[model samples]
Target chain A: MTDGLWVYLAASPLLWLAGTLVVWIAASSVAKFRPGNPFLNPIMLTIAAIAGILCATGIDYGTYFEGAQFIHFLLGPATVALGIPLYEKLSLVKSNLVPMLSALVVGCLAAVGSTVFLSELFGFAPAIVASLAPKSTTAAVAMAISSGLKGDPALTAAVVVFTGICGAVVVTPMMNAMRIKDFSARRTCVPWDWHRACLLRGSRRRIVFRNSYGTECNSNISCCTSVSVSQLDSEHLHVDAERRQAHKRDQGAGCRLSQWKSEPGKHRARTRLDAINGQQPRRRPYRRGPVD
Target chain B: MLNGLAILFTFQLAGEIVAYLLGGWVPGPVVGMAMIAVALTLTRSTSFLNPAHEGTVSTSKTILANLGILFVPAGVGIIQHLDLIRDRGFALLAVVVLSTVATLTLTVWTFILVKRLSGGYGND
Candidate 1:
């Protein structure tokens, strides 16, 4: 090669980055394309396409790796940047922490275990198994795991990238399918029937009470009736959340009407009583204190 | 960019020290992240999340955005492996395709199973 050609060849990294950026810019202009989604992500597609180019040209891996290393540098911080989303969703993480940690552990184990086992059973060689072991985590984490295990980092890196791409793409469809199953299992039904049952029972129960003036009259009848209604209905339509809310509102109005009748002198006092003995606190059994 | 530099330096320092202390079992960044999360919670403040100091984050992204050139070196490795094509080409292809499939399957399955157990009941 001529000296000018040699000088040009040495500047390949700048060309690669510029080319990749151009690809991203083009992909973004496409309406159907989405970043982060494996199917449409420009970065991933570009990476794959570039790899294809190198493979076709029979270029040395060392030279390709040099140009690619700049992109690789960003991987570390991008892995860290995941914390930004994690932080935004921190409340969800904290509130459902047990589930989150449990998910992480279970997900990691199932991922590594199943992949390793199945690959072995299917007769993949040891290098491939070592490479496959860290596919669930981000590329940086996967790279570390592979290196620690003495696996080929390149193969591990490739697997990690592909896994991330698939996750970005397939997660949505998978979730939609699960929701379909959840909805199909518990068909929504109104709670009117349960309230009617409670009302019928209440009608038979004789709800007469002493008025504020000490005269004999029905009092807080609606409240008592609604409570009975909600209880009776809880069994039949447990997942009919909307119906339950509506029933509770109807019950509350009934309670107020009856309460006024029973104690025209002290509606506030009756509310105070309700407040004193209302909802119970929720208990979380697995917290196990700070020591654990 | 400066703010980002601070964040990066902070995490890098924290990660290196913690990882060193821990015998490098896990990564330094992981430790730094945990520490930052803990710190933010204890402070119970969103000031740390302010966009005012986030020029660094934007610039850092820009740097990454302009980073397509780095992969060419690794991509060049295909040159020496051309003979492997005449020999172990099929084996290499099998390894790549199978590994990709296996990785995808494991991630999806685990995420599903975890969500089920956690009662989150969905994917992304």
Candidate 2:
């Protein structure tokens, strides 16, 4: 009777949803304690924990996925929802159109070219090479591209996740060490969501300030700005703190533009920082006015 | 929430139609994303699909917040390829890591160089 019950429970779709949510919540809670360690990446932890459970229970992946498809279906709408952020940042994107387009083309080509060349050099099968070709793109898009090229969608999905984690772990520290602080370049190269999640979750300080050259300094960590970039001095740091506080206070009110108007220098710095970070400073509703 | 979803699906459906007509050279969702992005740009001055609207923003955030969950099913699919991975795990790891770093570095540097050559930071 118990074995029969176990089989029925394992086959239910609710089992997968409940298991995934419980594991993810537990992993995220654990991650909070470490605060800034990439190894504790919540997604990685949750995947391991659940995979271990599935293996131990001898439940096949197909059964689990059958239940999990409910969550998976949301990915389509979520992907389409990416337009929200892209829409929010339309003006910034429009202003930098030329450079942004060029960077995107170059980045896409480099991602595919390097993966293919290295996979070939390493003697990976052609299918594996094809899967790796679109590894840097979002998983849904990568899977489609991989299928079109005759690669395994499952392998492509796995590689895409691996690539994201690798980029999250390696790139930030490498860029910091090299002192490559150009905001435009960073914005152009790094996918927006990946960069935000990695930087925000990994650092205790919530707000990051970019100096003119693009080096990011944690502004709120010490109740004062910690200026790590060589070009910025204490004076700029002081101004950055004031501006950040003002911006935060007004953030809820959606009056970022008004605050910006109050201090042109602060506004310029804030805009520059937002651009560099690939974030948009929150703004109030659009109003038809001569001053807007 | 429903309205936001409606807008999303509508655009996705339109993209599918276009892609189908064009023989699927590009993926439908991607084309849909571009179409939505273009629509947003055109409608920025109006409130038609203002992303800042409370309902839309909150709904979009909820969907994106759990974005990792969407990839879980696919990641679990890795179980099927365990044999291939076991045989070439080390080489696969090395290539993925090296190629990712190389691509990121090259992309960032190339963008910076191009931006500088184009007279820096454009009009913004």
Candidate 3:
């Protein structure tokens, strides 16, 4: 009787769609417990869990995709929605218009060119190279580009996630090593969403950074560097010390670090971070003090 | 929310149309993104007509905030390509990591150079 019921439900597209959403919600909640840990990525966890279930059940990917495609269809509208953040940051974009545009063009070339060149050097198949080419872009856009290039969209998505995690994990160490004193410049290294994934792990540090320097954080780039710096402090003491030394050279950041320690949460850093990421903060448990 | 979604879809539809005309070299949604940016810029003067108001921004934000999950379905296709991954996994990872680091470094340096040429320094 249970097998019969399972067969009936499995045939319906709603089953997997509903299952994916349920799993996602659960994973996201769990991820909140250890936001600083990169391995605790909600999407990664959800994908693994869903993939594991499918493998265990001996279900084909094609069958699971029938239901999951509903979620996939949303990528188009979401891509269009990206314009909102671009528009909101228009003023800042305008100020650094020349630099931003030039950097964007150069960055796009470097990302694709380096990927292709390196993939060729490694003697990867053409399809794999195409898939890797667009991995630096967000998954939605990258998958689209990959498919257009006659590459595997699935492989592209995996690569994109891998690329994002790599970028997130390396941003602090890299920026510190480069000695990029400009907070705004440092923030430009990683894409916004991936950086947010990295930064979200340490809410309390973000709150401290925000409360101590909220007004100055009016610009998105400013907030990102300070928040990430504060977040990475616990994970990398030596790097944190180097950053503090760099901050000491800048009067504002030097004092703010000291002030951040004593300052209680006057403003909601959650909301600020959300606003920066072009999303409102969801209602979740508020854990005060350091997350680490 | 509905209205905002309509606007987003309309832009995406337009993008799809454009991509079709361009022989699909560029993805439709990217074209749609560009269209939205252009429309936003053109309508900057008119607040009522502007799409960057609260509703659209909120809708987009909500969508983008959870954007990572949207790709899970596609990534699961990895099951079919397990052999490929098993063979090329290490090499693929090295390429991605090196390229990303290169991209970040190149982008940041270019940005700094341009910023310095245009002005003295960015606001700290």
Candidate 4:
């Protein structure tokens, strides 16, 4: 019975899935406990925990990967799924296309160029430089780019993961200290999802700093959402003003409608009320305080 | 959920075909993403293209939420290159950290300067 159980556990994908999920959940739980503490990042913690487990169990990476590949397959679909958010905020993206695109291009070049230059300065191999070239892009793209440049895909993957974790860990505090509050610039430079993932609240203007190893899709989505929200807010204000003016113009037409118009002032008041009542309740549990 | 997945996969497949026909210079998934975005713009009237739809949004969120997990297997493969890491670890670490911070600062400052030059805001 014991021998049979060991074989089943080793052969089945369940062990890997269960292990990954448990480590992730536990890491996230610890992250929640510490709140803004970057050292407790779920990704870093999960990686460390799993690496420890594999090392302890003496399981070769090949066997471990056979089961892990099941989870890895979802990455492709996830990359495609990024289209949802991108589509939703397409208009905002279109409006700021020039600035956003220029910034992205410059940022991408800086990230890749600096890595290659520094690697060469340190006398590293060309393969290592190639692997590092796409370190700031998403894992899938980075791997593909690495392969194209004749770099080791596995090395690129490791470097990409490390860059992401470092970005998540170090960037937030640095941003806070630097007092970088320009939302447009911030949106263009940093991945907003990192802020969302960090669970920080208030100011809504947190710095994201995605220049190191942020994925293109994520940075695009962040830029779109930031521009959209601000644009939508302005549009909403303009519409409200127009409605108020229309109400004043139509006051002579009908008494009943005028009675409705009497409450035009209340429209802004009600929306503010609705915004506070509707939006805050949903987000309050997730956000512990104004800063953290 | 199923529909969202199918749509994404279909675009990705089309991208793969295009990339292959074009000598595979560009990555298939990136091309697929661009195609999907273009399709979404061209077919904005279609209800299925609505990103806010519950199924589409939820499916996207669920998949992206755990993106880090998908990279684990590849990261673990680093064990095979322990020698490379050991030989060049310090340089690699310094470059990644310093260059990342430098890139972030440069990008952010450049964006602000560009935005200012375009007269988007009055006061810096």
For candidate 4, write residues A220-259 as lDDT tens digits.
Answer: 2112222222211112122224444554455432323334
* Candidate 4 displacement at residue A114 in angstroms: 0.3
RMSD of each: 20.7, 11.1, 9.7, 9.5
- Per-residue CA lDDT of model 3 for B1-124, tens digit only, reads 8767878888899989998998987778777876787788777553534576666766776777677778889988888878887898888888989998898898778878988988837465
Cand. 1 TM to true fold: 0.56
Q: Is candidate 2 or candidate 3 better by TM-score?
A: 3
Per-residue lDDT of model 2, residues A70-151, tens digit only: 8777766665666665554455555555655666666666777777898899998898888778777777667777888899
Q: What TM-score does the A-chain of candidate 4 achieve?
A: 0.66
Question: Candidate 2 versus the native: TM-score?
Answer: 0.76
Q: Please write out the lDDT profile of model 1 over residues B1-124, one tens digit for every residue.
A: 7676567556657766977898987766555545544554555433544322455445444543333223223323334444644675455444444544443344334434555777765544
User: What TM-score do all the candidates reach, one by one?
Assistant: 0.56, 0.76, 0.78, 0.75
Clashing pairs in 2: A181-A214, A181-A215
* Candidate 1 vs 3: which has more DockQ: 3
Ten contiguous residues with the weakest lDDT in model 2 chain B: B44-53
Tell me how far the alpha carbon of residue B59 in candidate 2 is from the true structure, in angstroms, after superposition.
Answer: 1.3
Name the top TM-score candidate. 3
DockQ scores of all models, one per candidate: 0.11, 0.46, 0.57, 0.44
> Proportion of native contacts in model 2?
0.62
lDDT of 4 at A291: 29
Error of 1 at A92 (Å): 1.1
lDDT of 1 at A172: 34
